[model samples]
Target: MNDFSPALYEVLYVSTLATDQPLSVVAEIAGRARIANAQLEITGLLIFDGQRFCQQLEGPKKQVLKLIERIRNDPRHTNVEVIHHGPLAGRRFQHFSLAFSTVEDEDALARMEQLDGSAALAAFENVCEELEL
Candidate 1:
């Protein structure tokens, strides 16, 4: 048998919610993502704060890009802006196929959505620590 591991890639993005009914819609999206992400060997976190979505996806390069393309084309999400995307040495969320979180208020959402690049990533990491996931 051959032992090989695919190159790992990660993507961080923020988007606006287009649907009026967020709770149910977000729930349905997360539920479907959990199964699909697992099959694709992806692991990450999804954060929603009423009007915005901040998500991080990590996996093999091709699969991660394809998943981001799908998210870009999804109607439920608008302004799908990728904050970061590139190689990762290891997984930040190895155990979760699609870990989910909700920002308690608009201030928290604004803080997360306002930045770009590594700062945005750091904000997400802070959330991960708070959630202890």
Candidate 2:
């Protein structure tokens, strides 16, 4: 029996939205991401403020890497920072979604900030471990 597990890659990207870009702009970007995810079999979460976006993408390692490279080359974003990345034991998100919220939505912002933090990554690992996915 083949014991090899599928490689899972996770990346956290932070990018600035163009100044005065409309909400429709974000929607367009999210629409593109959704299409890419569907085509690539990637799953993850996208979070955005009016002017910035932070997202996590997890999937087969090679595919995720290719997707990230494409995202870097895309002109829709500037100042993209890859905050976290590595092989994940399992997927963090079961499907792709663009979850929109404002900075004024303090609780939501705080949750996303936590996910972006070092501590939460460890916690995420623990959760994945417990779930045994």
Candidate 3:
């Protein structure tokens, strides 16, 4: 019997910070998520460009879906838009449970916000390559 799974799942999304959300809340969320994601065997990167957030989560399909659902309901985030989601051949962020980055390229970030589907995913991939992580 084969025990290995064929692929891992990943979700890519962009969201806006809630009007009343404090900047300090990002650190708090990442702190808690690191612990929880590790337990769930999830790995991902979170990018914050001032007012917007772009995140890519990779793990078991079920767990990733559940986490996205929770994120959708979190009051600290609004306009949660899932740009891409599906099975991935491997983990893009295997080492970090929830690695974080803050981007300074407003123009690039703006382009990502306007894209959807594969284009959006491509933008995210470009951002990942540019990141030091």
Candidate 4:
């Protein structure tokens, strides 16, 4: 019989536009992130509120942590913080390696704000629910 490894998930936080990154540049960043994540089999979603960035990554623990280390050293973003991390029964983001979305709806923004500070992971789930992606 063969054995398999369990999956782990992690959530990362970074200051939004804290580096004064323009939308075009952020798009570039997202593109790069998607590429790297795909190569490492990382799956997750990146959420933005024009104020900050919150991302959830799910995969094998070793790969997930390694990718996170690279993200911590990335100069394009600051205040890199890992807010939530642990083993997961399954990957929440199984469809995309790196999914990017923005909160443009006023009401959605309010709902997300309510999840921040003490509810970051939940906030990620909420954003996914709203986007259906």
Best by lDDT: 3
lDDT of 3 by residue, 2-117 (tens): 12643589999989889898999999988999999998888899999988899999988999999999999999999999989999888888889999999878666667878988
TM-score leader: 3
Task: Indicate the residue-level lDDT of 119 in model 1.
Answer: 86
TM-scores for every candidate against the unseen true structure: 0.90, 0.70, 0.93, 0.77
How do the residues 30-53 of candidate 4 rate in per-residue lDDT, one tens digit apiece? 899888888777788887776666
lDDT of 1 by residue, 36-98 (tens): 999999999998887888899999999999999999999999889988788998988888899
The lDDT per prediction is 0.85, 0.64, 0.88, 0.69
Q: For model 4, where is the 10-residue window of minimal lDDT? A: 1-10
lDDT of 2 by residue, 1-133 (tens): 1125367778877677766566688888777778768677677766665666767787778888888888788777776777678878866566433333334442442344445556546533443343322
Return the lDDT, model 4, position 48: 74
- Model 1: weakest 10-residue lDDT segment is 1-10
| TM-score of model 1 vs. true structure | 0.90
In model 3, which regions exceed 4 Å deviation?
Answer: 1-6
Model 1 segments more than 4 A misplaced? 1-4, 20-22
RMSD (Å) of each candidate, 1 decimal: 2.4, 5.9, 2.6, 3.7
Candidate 1: Cα lDDT at 20: 60
User: How many clashes would you count in candidate 1?
Assistant: 0
